[model samples]
Structures are given as structure tokens and as C-alpha cells.
Target: MQKHIYILLTILSAGVLMGCEGYLDQKPRKSLVVPETLDDLQALLDNAVIMNSNVPGLGLLASDDVFMEEAGWAGLFAEMEQQTYLWRRDGGFEVIGEWNGAYQKVFYSNVVLERLHEMEEVVSANERGRWMALKGAALFFRGSAFYDLVRIFAQAYQPGVNDSEMGIPLKLTARVTERPGRATLEETYKQIIGDLNQAIEFLPVTASSLNRPNKPVAESLLADLHLQLGNYSMARDLSSSLLQAGTLLDFNELNPEDPFPVPFLNSEVLFQSVMAVYSFTFSSLVQVNPILQASYAANDLRGRIFLNRQNPQVVTFKGSYCGNFDYFAGISLNELYLINSEARIRTGDVAGGMEVLNTLLEKRFEAGTFQPLEASSVATALAFVLMERRKELLFRPSRWYDLRRLNNDSEYATTLVREMGGNTYILAPGDNRYVFPIPQVEVDQGMKQNP
Candidate 1:
């Protein structure tokens, strides 16, 4: 069901309006017994473009959607795809999609959460759970959205850091009234962590195995957070738990003729993308990056997942499924567990970590070739884990986050900065361009854009 219908059902059952009131009053959420100009607030909900993500055109530009006559969404996220490391300043049309989707969805999530309890008691138990889960999920998403924005839009996270660094503003509980000032880097990270942690506590254990958030999702995120904060042990523990709990999508089971077909194509996926309601991302714009196609071995499962044959080169994206997906975004348990194992390795548990990583990878590669790790030191294992991460998580979104963490090494950072920007656009440690600018509209209304 669409997320909206779930909301509407919750509201209408709750009297969608307060009783003992004038017959003419119409408020979807009767929390306010005040007189209103409009009937139900459903109209507000209707006009609410709580974005799903990418906003189609945005995804096209960000990836490989070809809508315009001049530019296929190729050049926009071009740098990132090639690991050239791109950043946008001024929040141009280039980035407005992310800004708009994030803020708008945050507002929509706010509306639902704020009014969910006021609705009637007739809502079913599972329904209520789903509703609350959705609310928490939305909050988690917004928090993450902000986190991503801040991470790229501002400076990279430096451990034991000061609070004065630029971080995105926190916007919780919707924007019914005022704009908030920029939160401290510490404050923003706190909010993001807070929301995600709370989301882990509330949402269903299995939200989206592939693309969306859930309990495991929350845990995986926490694992990432702890890793970034240098809490290696905590990250290792979180990773272990998520991996043990979540199911893996066996790529070994790929049907050669139709790799991306239903059964959702991935067992690790808890839920698939749904467009009829609570909508936004579909695989509508996925062209395999040339780099990816070149990197994949002919025998690799990913090669089957991608398209090859660009002009003379054999590179492809989502193939026929590029613009077609019909379900909630999926969440992949497989990748999460692998990342967890990697974290374990980083924390000096080479044996334990390799056990987890090899289990997944053995199933990924052909029969008898999985190499078990017997690390001599933390550094070697950590290096191995990082390489494994790149090899395993090719097209996933996790790479962006991984890149942020790794971008700190002066040499690594400089190389990436040069690769993406070339000579003229050299990226500095404290440059604002490293992060996305807050939307002009938000800034006009007094939002503190990253410096």
C-alpha cells in the first residue's frame, strides 16, 4: 500500500477530526480543535511532495538517465562514478534534487509522525506498527540525508574534533513555522545518530533488505557511524549483529537470461521498491559505468547485472530495468554483513572477521577459491578489508560514505581531489565545495550554508 493510504486510514479512523465540534469543520488531524479555512489537511498532504529520492530527473543527471536532448544524466555524477571525487557548490540545479527531496520528505514524515497518535483507535495493531515504522524510517532517512549532505557539503569528519566545524542544520518535526540555524558539526552528527539509533529501536526488524531502512538498517548505519568515529570495537559488534541476523542475497542464483527480474533478483532484499504509494526511487536511470564494465570479469555475477556494449566498449547500467521498478526499495543484508566483517577485521579480529567475510564471498565466487585471512597485524587486515569493500559493494550507495572516511589521508585526498577536479579546481581541506551548498531558498530564509 502507498504510505499515504496508510496515513489516511490512520487519520480517518481517528475521527480524522475531533468530535463534538461544528459539523462544517474539516481537519484530517483533529489534534487542533481550532477553526480552519480548509477541510481536511489531506490537501496539504496531497500537495506535499514528500520525495522518495532522486526525483527521476535528478537521478538521471546524477547517474545515466537520458531525458534531455543535450545531456544524458552522464556528466553530473560523472566524477563520483569514476572515483574522480566530485562536489557541488552553490546548490545548483545539479543538487537541488537532493536538497528538495530531503527537506520535503522530512516535512512529510513530520506531518505523519506529529499526527499519527491523534488518529482513531480502530487502526490495526500491525497497521499501527507499520505506520510508526514508516514515521521512524522517514526520520532515519532525513537524518541520513542531512548526514550525507553535511559529510560531503562540509569538512570530512576528524576524530576528537572541535564543534565549530560546518554541519547541516537539523530540521525535525516538519517546518510548520520557523527555520533552524545550522547545528554544530557535533550537534548535527548527534541528531543523525540519535534519529538512526531511535529508528533502530522502533522500526520493524526487517524494513528493506536492499534499499530502505529497518532495524538491521539502523544497526548497519550505527556500525558505519561508530566506524567513522573510530569506535572500532563498537562498530565491529554492530557489524557482527547485523550480519548474523540479516539474510544474504545469493548472487550465485542468477538466471542468465533475466538477471534483474522479480523474486526481486536478490534474496537479501527485505522489501522492493513500490511506486503506487509512498513513492520515489526506482532503478529508472542506471547505465553501467564504463569503469564498472571494464572492471568486472566475464564470469563475475556483476557483469551479468550490468550492460556491456557501449559503442565499441562493453559497458552497461541497469539494462532494460533502467526506468522500471515497482516496489519499495530493497535493502541488502548481504552487503551489510560483509561490511560488518570488514569492520571486525579492522578491529583486530582477523580470524573472526575473515570467517564472516569468507562465508559471504565463498558463495559469491566460484567453488573452492575463498581465501581465509590470517593477519599479522591490524594494518594489513584493514587494508585487505578496504579492498574487499570496494570489490564487493560496486554500485551500492555505501561507497560514497566509504570515500568520505578514506578521503582524509592527505595523499589519498589529494589524489582524489586532483582526479575529479583536475588542476584548476583543486579541493582544499577546508573548502566549501567539498560539501554541497544548502539550497538557495533555505539560505534566503536564513539557513547557514556551509562555508
Candidate 2:
């Protein structure tokens, strides 16, 4: 069964790569089996290797949280990695894993959804629950893939002014021959939100595994999207409602000596997914940004647990929530807490915001040496929350999205600088380069490229 699914996925991927037409016209072989049963569709979605892992890592590479020394920069295995790190504007780079990987997820979701729709008419009373769950899962996966694509390939979504900007193409069906050009930013977001809303209604309160989507996962993702859109009140309410379901890990109980101190599928994780692996991510020469590493206090257990000090002068990140070398890029309770805190502060509940922030921080610091953080004004409270957010979520794929949305506000805007081999490259806030150019292969197929 797994072999058949792989063959189907291979065919779908080839169709996508071959100009989205004619490839589907090839005669079906005996080995190629179209998914028609609930079990068959479920198995496809259950293939975590294809569905949950290898999300885009370009955003992490482009973000300012990590840096490479001159030697490390020169030693990178791929020219694409160096180009992404430098934030190059040219379209000379070829198709990357990030783009192909995300669209593969989209293809998988579309396949499941199309099959589910066909099976819906004949679904028996006993199988209704499974049917709904499968549909909800499909929508969640597709919405997630779209969200990641837009954040990397399109401009930051401004609520009122920039809704007309070109967003990633919305591939809603299994048909590869249909070329649905780029949708507007507004349409893309609406589709994402709509899918999640319906998914929330259909999904059970819990899933069998962390890799699967459930009601809480969908709601949390929706809240995250709201936070990104600057809808503070909505984000505040959603995150607050889900707070009781979260459990934070105490850093004091962890062993800092372990190469990966955090355990896989730990209490804080609400979902499980990993970033696409890049050679530089695990290279010895790559080090955590000095400023970010310096922000942790002496008593803060996170600094000790999250960073591996190679020598007096060097530090590299070893605290992936994945509990190994794989960089975790999934939603977590820690992230929700930060989101709730920031939303409360932004919505004029500074005191409430600080309280939530303190709760999470208490678990992060050494038990006896920790003190509750406070703020007298919204500005001060927001600053505290934002700082903790950066510290807690470092090395995740979110920094790029955070940079894009935060750059819209003059007070929060940031200018990223990278120096390598005696040359300094700067990316100003709101720079056009922030929106990565669509893969040249996609461009050659008539897709519009970013300027």
C-alpha cells in the first residue's frame, strides 16, 4: 500500500514539474492505483514523511537569528544557500527544495480531498466520523502549505492597502492541467481562513498523534494567523481559550549536557513538523547570533539548555524541540503563550499580558532565582513580550514572518545586516527582496516573478 502511494505521489510530482499539462495524459499502469477507499486516503495523509516534514527552511535561512562565519559561508555546499543567506534579488537561482516540498504537500492534500469528496456521497453512518476527520485533515494540511508559501513567496499582507498584491497560486483540485494563476493576497488569506474555520468544525478535539491536525491545532494556527494579521483581539481570545490545554516544560528538569535537551513530541508541542535540512544548519562553523545569545540572563536556564558552547568564543544552537538535529518548525504551547501575551498587550491589557508572560518565563528560569517580570505601560509590556518571543522561538521558521509583519510598524521595524568576507549586506525593512523571487522554473512556465 505504501509503495502504491509513493508511485502516485511520484506521478503527481512529475506532472507538476512537467509544465502542469500532458503529463497526466500518460496511460495508467497497473502499479498506479487511484485512492478510492477511506483507508487508502487515510494512509496517504498518514505518510508523515511526505505530509508533515520538510517544510520550507528558506525563511529561517533569511532571518537574522543565526549567522555563519567567513569560513562557514565559503564552505556552504550549495550556491542557493549562500544566495538565500545574502538575500539576493536576482532570479538566477534554480528551483529549491522549499518551493518543491511545499507544493508536494499541496498536491498530497488535493489528492486526499478529491478522493474524500467522491467517497462522501456513499459514506455509511458508521464511517461518517472517519470521513469528516479525513476531510478536516486535508483542509488543514492544504491551508498550512498555502500559508507557508505566501509568507515566503509573496509580500507581507497589509490589511487594507496591499490586499491586491500577488499571492501564491491556490491549487484546489487534483487536476494538474488546470493552471490557476496567482491569487490576490486577500483571496489567499480568505481561502486559508475559510479552510481552517471549516476544519475546526469538523475535526475532533484531539488527534491520535501529534503529527495529525485536530480542533486545537486548527484553532491555534488560526490564532497565529490572526496575530500575524495584527488582529490582536481575535488572537487574544483564541489563544486565551486554548491556554488550559497547554503544558510548558520546565528547563530546570532538563539536562543541559545532552546534545538535544528538548525531547521530541514533548508536552509543549501541539504539532510536529521539521524544517527542510540545509548543510549550514548543522555545520560547525555556523553560530547563534551574538546579540541573541547575550539576551539571556545568568539565571535563565534556557540560555544554558538552548545553547551549546563550543568554546569561550563560540555558541551553536542545540535546543531543537525535535530533540535531535532536525530543526522543529511546528506550533507549540510556548509560541501560543507568547502570542497571547503580545495580543493582550497590544489590545490594552498590559497587566494581563505581563501576567501571561511571567507564567511562561517562570518555567524558563532557574526556580529559586527567577522573578516575575512587570511593566508599567503598554510600550514597556510589549517590549518585554517581544523580547521573550525572540528568545523563546529562536531558530524556528517563524522569525521571517515575524520580521515581515513587524517591519510594517515604524516602531518595530528592523534592518538586517550580514558581513562575510569583508563585505556587508543590508536588508532594509520593507525591502522588495524580502519577498523571494518565485523559482525561475515556475517563472518560465508563465508564473509572474517578484521584482
User: For this target, which candidate reaches the highest TM-score against the unseen true structure?
Assistant: 2
TM-score: model 2 vs. ground truth: 0.94
Candidate 1 residues 206-289, lDDT tens each?
Answer: 643334456776777677777876678888887776665545645566443463432443455543332221121232333344
Question: Which ranges of candidate 1 are over 4 A from the true structure?
Answer: 1-52, 55-94, 117-135, 206-213, 256-265, 271-299, 307-314, 319-330, 369-375, 410-414, 417-431
Write down the TM-score of every candidate: 0.69, 0.94
Q: What is the C-alpha local distance difference test score of candidate 2?
A: 0.84
Cα lDDT, model 1, residue 380: 70
Model 2: clashing residue pairs?
A: none
The clash tally of candidate 1 reads 34
lDDT of 2 by residue, 166-192 (tens): 998898866656667889999999999
lDDT for model 1 comes to 0.50
